[model samples]
Structure formats: C-alpha cells, structure tokens
Target: MAASTCVRAGEISPGHDSFTGSPSTADRLTGSVAVDGQRRHGGSSRDVRRGRPTLVCPCLPVVDGLSSGRLDQDEGVSSFRKGDHGEPDSVRFEAAGLRWLGEAPGGVAVAEVLSEGPGWLETARVHPGGATAAAAEQLGRALARTHAAGAPHLGCPPAGWTGDGFMGRAQLPLRGTPGPDSWGEFYAADRVLPYLAGAVANGAIDTAGERTVRRCADRLATGELDAPQPRLVTRPAARLHGDLWSGNVLWGERDGIVAATLIDPAAHGGHAESDLAQLGVFGAPHLDRVVAAYDEISPLAPGWRERVGLHQLHMLIVHAALFGGSYGRQTVRTAARYA
Candidate 1:
C-alpha cells in the first residue's frame, strides 16, 4: 500500500497554471490522472517498459524489475499511470485519436503518447508555465491547420477509432447518419439534442429550459442556422478536438516563453466552430489573440461570432448532464438567444 505520487519530474503541475487552467481546481476535468512512487532499481529499458505497472505501487519488489531511472532514460516513457474498471479499450481509442490528429498534415501540437492498453494509458509528461500571447496566436494558427485537415463527414470518428467515443466522461457517438446534407441538422441531432435529452432525463433542466432548447432544435432542423450554403454546409466538416476546454490545454515554457500542448482530446469530426467556441468555455488566456490569429489563417464564416453560442450549447448541456447546476441554467439562457 505505498502511497502513489501523482506527479514526478516532467509532469504537469496541479495548479491554476497547469492543465486545468483553474488555479484553484483540484482534479483534472479532462479525466487524466498520473501515478508514480519513490523507488530505485537497475533494469534495462525493455525491463522498465514491462515493469511500468509495478511503478504504480512502489512497495513492489525491485530485485529483478523496472524503475523510474530506466524509464526516465528512455525519454519516451509516459510520465503517468491510470486504470479504469478493467475496460482498457477506451484508452486505446483515446490514443488512436491523438495519433491520427497529431500526425495530420500541419496538425496542432499534442502530448506525446507512450503506450496504451485495455484499461491504461501512458503519455509523455509536460511541465506547464504561464500563457503568452505568442503562444495563443500559434495555437490559433495550428488549430486552423488541424481543422482544415477535414474529415470524411460530420460525426466521423478519427481514423482507426472503433465504437462510440466520449467527451470528458460522457459518451459521444461518432457514427454519422446518411443524407443529413447540412451541418445544422447534424449538430442538432447528434450533438445538441442528445445531451439536452440526457439533461432533461436527469432533471438537470426544467420544463421551461427544455422548451427553449427544443425551439432551438427546431430552428436547426429547418436549417435556419446553416451558413450561406445551399443544400450543403458553407464550411466542410473539420477535425475537432471534441473537447477543448481551457483545462485540457497545457501551457509550457520553452526558451523562456509559453506555448500550448493539447491533452485528453475527445477528437472527432465536427464543425470547426465547435472547437473554437469550446476554447472560450472556461476561458483560455490570450483568447482574443488566439481568435485573431485563427481568423488570419482560416477566416471564420461571416456571422460566426453570432453563432458561437449555438456551437457552445452542446458542451453546456453536457456539463448540465454531468454536474447539474449553474450549467443547466446557462444552457437555457444560451438556447433562448437562438429561440
């Protein structure tokens, strides 16, 4: 029963300046946790790779096994450990999402993934620092490139990803329906309404709030929110981080300045605006700079600003489903704007 050290050298700090972006928050909203312990042993790199699980409990024997010393030397070992209820396949889905999006042409920077199994995942640890305007701008351009990578269709999962996906702890279906023919329809059916229904079922939303959201859905169904395109969306479905809240953005210092590295992505294919709007969810630093830079490279549609709330509705309802508090009220208020 050795106490687990949640962080070690090269690990992201647990503070406002770290991954969560909230200086006062504790657990990561992104649902990632790291485990390590203090112990030393002599083993080859392969031995360390095979011995990572033992590191989760420092009390384990070191006589013939792995150690952080060996792992650190590898320079590619993930700096954290996590386990779920014996269903490790979810971690594989997440790992695949990271690789598929990270390797896309001109993709945004992402945390390096070391390994993944049925119920565990390891990723290269990142040490975070303060945000910089330059870093925000760079992130914007990088995000533009990522979104521009495009996808086979809206609601498509990352290449090689199997089964339904997730956003934070909530299930996210990646399978797209045929003949939707418009972004508004895809979003209303696949993103907005499903979470809205969950929120209602869970009593997170009141009758009045549900009515407001339904009105918004009706508008979406009629394609009232579709950009200037006819029969098709004006913008193609872009690769999305799926969840881009500020906490998931790890800011790191390099050469005495700040830059961002993404982690815990719920990556999928969706409207690029969905990603952009989510950045402002908990509020990322230098947000204006990020948006300006993004516009410079891949300008948003005319009236995108007016549509920000539309895109944000999905996450807001998700929060209501998972937390069931102020988020629910906010969902109604946001939907009212469109209603």
Candidate 2:
C-alpha cells in the first residue's frame, strides 16, 4: 500500500486523529486527498486548490525515482519530526501533537538532473565550534521540546534497516515487534552484533574490532553490561531522530540552538539515549545542557552517562562502515574504550 502511495506522491491527510486536538492549526488535519480526487473542507474546492502549492526540494530528482512512491508511509509517518541525522531521508509531513507537528517519509524524493551547489548535506557543515557549542546545547534543548511533542503513531514494522552508514553498506535496526522478548536481547543481537559481522565481511572492519563487538554482545547478552532499567519513554514510544551525529546538527539563524530536525533516521521505538549518545560522539553542540533539559522533562537513568560510551560504539561502527577513513580509526578507538 505504501509503495503504491510513494509512486503516486499524492497529497494525503491521515483520517485518524493524528492531529485532531492539537492547539496548533497546522496540527489539525481536516481532510485527506480524496480517493476520487482532492477534497476540500469548509473552503471552496477552488480555495483548496488556491492554498495548495508545490514544494521544491533541491535533491528531489535523485529521490523521486528512488522512492517510486512505494516506500513505507507508515514508517515514514513515524519519522516526521526528529533530530535529523545527516541523510536526505526527509519526507512528506504527517500529523503530530506538538509545535508545527507533522510526519515525513524518505520516499517523497523526486527526480530531476542538475549539478546542484552543495547538496542535501548542507547541515553537515554546521559543526559545533567555539560559539556553536553553546548553540549545540540550545539545539539539544529544542530537540527535547520536540520530544515533548508526543510519540509517533506509525512504526517501521521492518526488522532490518540498511540505507547507509559507516563503510558503504551496513544493516541497522528499526522499530517494531521482534521475536525476541527483551529490548536488551533485541538490541544486542539484532542491532549491534549484526553490524559487527557485516563490517568484518565488507573488509571495512577487522578482527580486533569484530572480537570486541562480539565480546560486548556477549556481555550485554549475558547481563554483564551495566544498563539502566525502567528506561526513558513516551507514549507510542520515543520520537528519535535516530541517526543524530555532529554533522546532522544545524545552525539556525546566527545563534541559539534552533532545531534538531532529523534527516537520515533508523527511526523506531527505542531508547532516546541512543540519540543522545550519537550527539555526544560527534561532539555535537550543547552536550551538557541537552541532557539536563531532557532530564527536566524526560529524565534519563542515573547512570545514563556511563552507558553512553557503550551506545557510542554502535554509531561509531556505523560511521566506520560509511566513511571508512578516520571514522574507522574512531570506531576502533571507541570500541576499545570498552574492551
């Protein structure tokens, strides 16, 4: 169904109460694209037509054919507003319960050929620096606000996720029910351990790193790793930009942390700490305050900081798989931090 919708790329409004009671008018979804055609609410059909306008994304051409309107809209809906990681997985907006709430799928990509200046990765340039560090905190806090909005209605429902990461190709985890009963088992077996093996097979990884990952997996699997229980959560689950890193953090207007709008997301119902850990690894701006603010609203475990290094290993491995240069070095260093 979603694959068909992605091909169509038709204007849609979820009929569900996704945005029904939100105070923001933007969150109030009144109608959807009619099965027959475009539907108008109180305003004239002409009014609807008048208000509707086309959006132009610089990277559309490469994406349109790629998505073919066949991507998972349900999963896309889950990723609407997140602390964007640096991928062009931004998608069509869906409804939510917070500031200018909406959902987005990676499938909205459309195609046209052009030797564009820069690219969808403009956010990467906004690295946290002297002044930007303060902004990074603000950005982190704003991300917490986004968290306060409410959880996503849709979920990935897929077990495997492998769009891109460290070396060139690697599979990560997504949200949904797994056959495994515990989040710990699911995370270690399905998430980190798989990538450990994949990285080795791809030649981007080595024996030492592989052994460490396996060891970490063993400890985590056998209850050797110290992890906090009664994890941070939100209804419908946590709204993570999933793949947050330093490059993904953006500077919004001169200074002050603006938005942690997410890009490439392995989005799902999982730990909010995972997102924070990635933010920290890349030296993302405003590291200290981000966690403090988040704790004010959604407190993390007492020892969340200690566990962050463990979580950082996962993302470092991802980067090693994607970039394969210094990132691989970083991956080895970070993984060894535990071993």
Candidate 3:
C-alpha cells in the first residue's frame, strides 16, 4: 500500500497513482497545506461513480491534478488554490488573519493567499459505496451554481503558462497579455502551445510534432481554426480551474449546498466550459448530472461535446511533457480526428 501526494503541491494525493518507495508516505511536507493538519483523499474517479464518500470537507474542493506555485514560503489565506495542468506546485499553509506560507520543493511556487470564502471551488464528494441517480442530479445542479458565481475581482494573473513544458527553459513565447481577451486565445497560448514545446523538450515529441502545436496555436490566434467562436469569456476573463477532469467531481447529496469552491486549481480565467468539457473527457462521475446542473444555472454553449477532442488534446500533450511520448501520440491521434 503506497500513498501519493497530489492535486496541489502534492497535498491532494490519489490512493495509488503516485508511489514513493515504501508503502507509506512521509507525513511531513513542505510549504503550504498546513502539513499534517488534514490529509483529504477524495478517492478515485471510480469511487465517486458508486456514490461513496458522500461527506465532503466543506473547506476542500475537488479538482483534477496538481502543480507548483511561484511564491516563497509565506503565510495567508491563499486567494487561489495552488495547481497546474497536471498537479499542484506548492503546498500552502495559512495562518489566522490571512497569513500564508508555502513550500513546493517538488516544483515551482503556487500560492495566492487570501482568506475569503471559496464560492467558486464548488461542491466535491465521492460515492464511497452507493449509486443513486438523484445524487447525480444533485451534483449536476451544484456545478451549475458554481458557474453562476459571476466574475470575481482579480488578484493574480490568469495563467497556466509554464516554462517547465519547454525544453530546458527553451520557452515558447506567448503574446504578452496582462490577461487574455478571450478564452480561445488564452487556452491556445497557455495550455496548447506551451505544453507542445515542453513535450518536444522532454523528448516525448519531435520538432515536427511541435510544429503541429504551432499550427494549432496560430489558427486559434488568427481565428482560422475551423471551429465556432468558443463560449470563451472575454470581459473579466472569469476565474477557472485550469485543469478539470473526472477525478475532480465528487458525487454526493449535500443538502443546502449551493456550490463547492474549486480547490487545487491551476486557477485562471478563460472558458468555464473548459472545466465541464474536461469532466466529460475523463468520465467524471455523474457527468450527465453535472452538465444538467450546469445547464440549470446557465446553459452550455452548443456543440460542447464535439470540442472535447480538441480540449483533451491539451491535457494529453501536458501528460507527454510530464511523462512521455505515448501521450503525445495520443494527442496527435485526437487532433487528427478533431481540431
């Protein structure tokens, strides 16, 4: 039995996804997450499907993978949840009065200390051992509520751009945007292109493959990609959990729960649907329920499913960067079939 660190600076570990030597994980961790305060494992996607783990920590929101942040160890109520496209960067430790400290010895620093309530984190729960259709509907409604939270005041820049995705700092330059004008531009620049460079640098992809990414990025940039105008948000950019997948959705029937804040986010602003589509891609529990829920709060832009292949390619490329070529190949296949 081994344990893994996760979804954020390694705090939200999966049951068996990451193993560090022996069957046990060291309790001590660096930077944030208030080391040892609480170890919350939101179970795996399968667990959620069965309707187990119905009880969710109101303070913790479910999320996709992990990441590292950029701040040195300090203390405050992280305005955002530390994360990236894959996993969390830094673990955050917050003291009273909004003081925050962080540690991401594993990677970069991910901390946006803030003390306010997390309305966007949204609801997350796992169905430890049950399967109820109503639970699915409940989850659906909850997600809709999260999307309806409206744009909040911004603090840090909305970003998922990482130099790590590049070959030894051979970063792909994205046009400077204090923030993006639309979700399409933001996703194209940050998620799609940068990860392709990282995959090339990591040897998962060749220069030729990288060219495809450039082609894709260029298309979106020029509005030439054969696709509809993304339901991409323009004004306010809108806060989004940079990575959203099946594991991020927790299945539970929490009464009176309006929404669950997005925790462990590679937080930024772009198409909120990015999260929804991702959920569908990874087969998040009660996916139909979540979509139904989202629709109630605010309807989805049409033809969202068809774009899954397009959005999922970004995630696969990211995997290639962090792991290896298979993900790259998978990405290429998807691109050939879709956008």
Candidate 4:
C-alpha cells in the first residue's frame, strides 16, 4: 500500500458501460473496463442491438485491483469502481468514510455511492474539467465546515469505519487516545514516529537521518512544540480528508457552476489545520483564495501559516518510507525546521 499513490478524481474523463453475458461494441467504447464473462448481452458486436444504447464507462487506476470509472443508467452517469480485495468489510470502510464526510455540515462534495459489495463499489461520476479560483474558495469554506463538524479525538477514524484505514495503498492504523494533551503528541506517536521507524528499518533513511527524526519526534512527544492557544486552533476533532493534496480535489462545472469535489479520502478526526496545510504539499491551485475563504469562515490561529511545514512532515516521512529516495532528505529538512 505504501507504493500506491491516491488519484485526483477531478482530472478523469467519464463514460459508462455494464457487463452482462457478452462482448459488444458498446463494451469496446467503454475503455478500461473488465468483465468476467465473455457472452454478449443484447447481440453480437456487429448488431446495433436496437432499443437502448449500451453505456461505456471510464475507470480510474486505483492501488492493487480497485478500479474506478463511470456507469450509465437512466438515473444519471454514476461513478463506479471495483475493488481488488473481495471483502465486504474493505469496501464498507471506505464507503462509510465517504458518507460521513459528505454528510457533515459545510460538508464535502463527494461522488455519490450507488451500491457496494465485496470487491466492488459503484458511485456517481464526477467530471472535473479544471480548477477555478471560485471553486478553490468554495472548497476552503466547505473544508472549514467539515473540520468544524468535529470528531471524538485525534487519529480517530470516521464513524462506522472500525477497520484500519489506508494512506495510498499502505494500511494506516487508526486509533486515538481517550484525550490527548496536544496534536503534536498524537501526530508523532501515530503518524510520524512509526513511519520513521519503518523507514529506518527499510534503509530508506540512514542512521543519521533516523536520529534527526527521532529528536524531532521526541520533541513532539514532550509537547514542547505544543502552543495551545496562538499556534494551534483548539477545537473538537474536526473531520479531515486525511489525504487532501491537490490531486484529490476534483474540479468540475455543473449547471454553469464550477467547484472542487473531493475524492479518494483517508477521512478521519484530526486538527483542521492539518488538512489545510496538506493543500500545499503538492501545491493546490488558487491556494491563496482557498486559505482566505477558509479563514473568513473559521479564523485560523495566529502563526498557523508557519506551521504548514510542521503538519506536512507526516506525509513527507510517509513518502520517504514508501518511495525510499530523496523524499527522506526532504522529510528530515521539514522536521529540522521545527526541531
């Protein structure tokens, strides 16, 4: 799971197709779809198979065997995907997370889940044409609302998602302390320190780099970095799109309105600012507008901007552990800033 990267749902093109006993020209029109059977549904490829035209859907590349694309039906073109793991529990966890986030106040706009079963999830397709400043601003505002929705504690998974969550393809353990003194502590213990250890064991981070990270991690644990009032925004655990990089923010227009729709969430309860900081990880377009809008709705704490790199350390280290390259160096640099 570490090697897998999450896809940005907005950039994908959508179409729809269904599998039923046979190969049809309609099936060919829907690229990237796979079906178990070979028999055609209506007629042979040569026949028009009159009455209704078969819908061809587009599929997105997900980690392992999970495939996402569009499905055609009278209701509308729905976003659909099939999971690699044939377990209902796996699909249920993600589906539950998406639903929880979508239902939150100023909630996120997510692809609607139509139906899900073992090894498969079907959803309403989102066609993101491009990112716009207006959309970015709206995203920021809504994100604040999402965070304000709150959680039981930091590191907690979305309601109903009891199983371990994921970051990309890597399994991420989701557990929270009864009540923590500071966000830094939980982040260090659950997010940073564990990944650092794994990176060191895999030779991704050399001994010296590992030592440096440990120092920063120790500081995190001691709560030295914790500045409760000014530096951090104290709030109930806010709902977080655990992975909020730009790619996950899908941009699209509907009814002449453009907006950012979130996809591929690693949703959880955590500091709202952490989700905001993640936007800068890979550089989100119109980030300034997004931040400004968010701040207007839910004012951020003083010096929150400076903490961007601090929050980003978790993802950097995760990348280092998984990709094993210059990412390790980048992680250390970010950690050193706060250390």
Candidate 5:
C-alpha cells in the first residue's frame, strides 16, 4: 500500500501492490517515475510507508491524505494532486496554467484539468508509454505552436492568475510591475536574480560563487546576451513551461497513439529557449528530434545552441536554493562562462 507502488488499473483501494513492473530507462534517468515502494519526488526523498498518504503514482504527490486513484464510476481514471501545506494557491495556479497552455491551437498536449478546488486539482491520467522519435518530433512542432501562443509580457504569469507561483516548491517570482523591455533584462531580473538570492540566503552558494553569478546577471541585465526575436512571433515573450525538465515531459499514450503530454509546469511567459534549454539539463529523450521539428515550424534564432548554458542558469540556481548540494557548484560553473 505504499504510495510509490503504481495503483492497479481501475482500483483505488489501499493495501494492493499489483504493479510489479520496473521503470523505464528514461524514467530512471529522470528519477521521477518508479514502480517500487521507494522513490524520489522532485529530488527529495519521499517514503509513503512512513506516515505520508499513499500516492496513486510516483509523479504526483498529495497532501492531507488526499491521494489520487480511480474513481470507479466508469468515467475513466483520473489523477488528483493537492497543494503542499502552507501553499494555498498552488493547485489553483496549476489549474490556470494547464487551461492557458491547453488553449493554444495545435499545441503540445497537456493533462486535461477535470476539476479544481482551493487545495486540490484533478486531471485525466495519461497512461504511460514508450518514447519514440516520431512522438518527440510531433511534440517539438506542437511545442513551437504553444510558444507561438505568446504572452502579454516577459516574466508574466499565465492569464487570470495573480501573485507569485512556484517552480517545484521554490517561490517563482512572477511579473508584478513592468519596466524591462528586452528578454535579457526580464530574465536577469525575474528569473536568475531571485533564485540566486535565495541560494545565497540558504548558504547553498559561497561568496565567490555569488559574486560570479552577480557578474553574469549584470551582463544579462544590460541586454548583452539577448537573442533575436523568434520568427513568426509579434511578442517577445513565449508561453513557457517554466519547469520543462525531462521529468515534466511525460511520454504517454493518448487516443490509442503514443505522444508527449506536458505536466507539472511552473508555467509563465519567458524566452522559448529557456524551455528548450531545460530539456537538455536532464537529457530529454530524442531531444534532437524535438528541436529539429520545432525549428521546422518556427525557426529558432541563430546562436541558440551557444546560449543554452545562459538560459539554463535559472533552473540551476533554483536547484541550488531547494536542494543545496552540487547544484550550487553547478550553478557557479555555468555562470562562470557568462561572467
């Protein structure tokens, strides 16, 4: 009855461990999916047998005993996710993000939000499947369309959402006042600086590393590292899955066909390359196909590959702030390049 064990299809009852399968290579690489009774949740150790409520799947965690499972009503299976304690707006924020992202015509697939309340959100369960080149390619093109949907401004939150959101339990600062025009300024101010400060405050970063990151941030704020606006977009800001790591890109079957479904987004308005760069942070499967197909739809600005490290700095600092281990060192190493 451990939460890490996969629930049997159409069953929500406790104390059943019917699923005995092993996680795939990609799942193992991401450390997000597991069939055994122990696994990591967002890089943090989680053991449901020790007083936490049993989760229906390893990817989704719930609080206050609000576990996800089959409804047994013939409407098919659904996954429930509840907000962590003290984060009241988390579930609502996620619901708004999913709705906004799903609005794009021909965009990447997102989990359908079935219902939501003050502390919990429910979504249709996407059955797990193997990743293929074709699926990755289609995801790439669809992702381009999603980014083309655009946002009102860089660093803006999803439409209809107010206040700040989260990026995997870390406070994700959203746009409150607008002044910076270019993506570089917005990214430096909203994306990198906030998490950098948090990492420092947590003692995850040393004085030397802090100084190095600040230098990088200064250059970024001066608009020195900004890339040209992507073709076919009027706005500078793209609708980004703010936390687009491989763990968030769920490869699964929908409508009897294999495809990618995006989940657990810290969705916002930002540079498109930021999303693309995150795919590389943890080695997304068939990433080359994803990017190539995306370029076919909306050609990326030149020199994008060269700027991957620049774009990836934010997520690294976030990891530093939250996990406080080698992530701090990694953040400094990446920032040293731009510094």
Candidate 6:
C-alpha cells in the first residue's frame, strides 16, 4: 500500500490529485504511462482522447514497485502498482500470490486483480474503512481458511512461480522442489539465516548480536523449537503470507461492510503460527479478536503463544538488514530467550 493518509471511500488524498477521476463517470481507460523516472509516453490513449492528464506519480522512488496509486476506470476504482526494473518479477510474483491465496475455499478477501502487463499490475481498490470488531473476526476466520489451503512443501513458493520472491525490497528465498522435511529447518535456512548474514554484513548487528541470533538459528535448524502441527493442517506446510505486518492488511469496505483485504504478500509455505505472530509485530488493531477468531476455527498447536517471539525473529532480522537501528537490537533481544 502507498504511504498516504487514509481517506474515506471515494475521497482522494491530498497531493495525489493528478491520478484522480470520478469512479462513476470515468470511461474505460488503458495504455501504459511511464512511472517514477521513466520517460513519459505523452499520455494514455484515453487520456489524450478525453483531454485528461496521464496517470503517474512523480513522488515515488524508481525502485519502489509496491508504491501504489488510484485508477478510476469505467468499471470502478482500481489500484495501480508500477513494476521496478531492479526487481523484475516483483509484480508477477505478487499477482501470482494474490491468485494463489484467493483460491482458498473460504479465504480472506484479496484485492481483485483487474489487469497486468510487463511493467505494471492493477487490482480493484479497497476503500479505507474502520477496523470494526466484526471485520477483525472475519479476517481471522478467513486467514485460517487460507492457511489450510496448504502448499506442496515447507519452502515452496506460490504454485506457478518458480523463482525467488521479494519480501518488501529484500530477496525472499523460495524453493519449487520439495524442501526440508521440517518447518524448523526451512524457517532457519530460508527465513532467518539469510537475513541474519545480511544484517551482520551491513553492520546492523554487532558480533555479540550475531552470535545470539546464530544460536537461535542453530536451535531452529536442529528442530529444537519445532512444535506439533495444528490439528487442521494435514499437509507438511501451511500457506503463509510471509510478510503479514500491519501495513499489509488493509481494513476496508467490501460488499458494503468493513472487512480485511490482504495485499503486498511475500506468500510461501510455512508454519501457520508465523502469520498470526506477525499481526502482533507492529500492533494491528483488534489483534486479540483476530487471533481468538482464528483459534476458534483452526485451533493452534499448544504452546503457540510462547513461540511468538521465535517466529517473529525472522521479520525482525529482515528489518535489521534493511534498516539498521533499533531493529537490530530488538532482534538480538528477541533471540536471547530462545538462544
């Protein structure tokens, strides 16, 4: 999602007027327009014919494919995401994830993918709404259904995608083949250690911090932290929204009522508790309700609460690698108990 202040349904955010159009009045719009620093191709054919400006955001960074903007077309309002040349497959990866997650029988509502092309992808826009308790509960139930969709193995990527995916701006390791037999092993190798090494190389964490995190990683690799699989999960892996931070969950209007719409996934196959733990990482609204609702449906493994920090270590280390500061310190502190 874009870093813009939340606005009510049908209202536009300040300083983003260039991309605005009346959802009810706009005609079918099409054609590619350069984003970020790319050269403008005059304007979309619809823009030229209708005497409107080409849709573009000048404030976005060149490498930020996740930066989003609104597009009002004849069908309705949609969210347009530009692709990053630096991360060529990011757009396709996200598209694949959305489709895969959406296929779950009773899964969480995802933004509908309207169209996609080489350098851009568009999806039905979710209008911002309050995170009501009812919405939170629905999100919980839906998320459990999504996890129950299952994947082929612990480290498998989305069904059709074979390459590595992106977690925010960082590389998210993935495997198409059957991965390690245990979730602990896959989590250590694909999730924690890679980001830990990056954090150390970037000076985000000191030697002591490295040792502490490595100790936790060693325990994870050895399956010391592995827990019994949830009763509902019959497969070796549960589908996961690899990055389930608060920002990625949009509480918005859906079907005339407020509901959660998941976006910007680093989707993969892993332990289900990781997704539940991530909701608490940055303080999601009504998080307790969400977790309770989820537990009602799927019944998490015993002692799952005690393992929250264990799962959260992956996200913390990724943040440490990307933005060295308190995140590094936080990672080390979180790893100490498990170490």
Show how many residue pairs clash in every candidate, following the order shown.
5, 33, 61, 20, 0, 0
- Give per-residue CA lDDT, model 3, range 1-339, as digits (tens): 113333322111343222111112222111111222211223323322442222221233334342222121134211222322332222211111012101211111222244322222111232133325565555445444433332422222223332221211122232324455544565677667766756787787777667666666666666444333223233353344445543443332235333222233444334555556555433344455555655665565665555555655655666667666456665555555433
Tell me the tens digit of each residue's lDDT in model 1 across 106-168: 767887787666665666655556678889899988888888777777888888886788775
The alpha-carbon deviation from the true structure for residue 18 of candidate 6, after best TM-score superposition, in angstroms, is 36
Full-model lDDT for every candidate:
0.65, 0.40, 0.40, 0.63, 0.69, 0.70
Point out the higher-scoring one by TM-score: 2 or 4: 4
lDDT of 4: 0.63
Q: Per-residue lDDT for 181-267 in model 5, tens only?
A: 888788888888888877888887999999999999999988989887566455757888888877677777778888998876889
Which residue window of length 10 is worst by lDDT in model 2?
A: 1-10
Judged by lDDT relative to the true structure, which candidate is superior, 1 or 2?
1
List where candidate 2 sits over 4 angstroms from the true fold.
1-138, 145-169, 178-181, 229-237, 254-260, 337-339
| Cα lDDT over the full model 5 | 0.69
On residues 239-304, what C-alpha lDDT tens digit does candidate 4 reach at each position?
Answer: 788877655666766778888777667888877867776765555677778877888878877767
lDDT agreement of model 6 with the native? 0.70
* Model 1 spans > 4 angstroms off: 1-78, 176-179, 228-235, 254-257
Alpha-carbon TM-score of each model against the true structure? 0.75, 0.53, 0.54, 0.78, 0.81, 0.81
Stretches of candidate 5 exceeding 4 Å from the true structure: 1-73
Question: Each prediction's Cα RMSD?
Answer: 10.4, 17.8, 13.2, 12.0, 10.0, 11.5
lDDT of 2: 0.40
TM-score of structure candidate 3: 0.54
Error of 6 at 208 (Å): 0.9
- Model 6 residue runs over 4 Å out of place are 1-67
Across 75-94, the per-residue lDDT of candidate 6 in tens digits comes to 44444444555566777888
TM-score of 5: 0.81
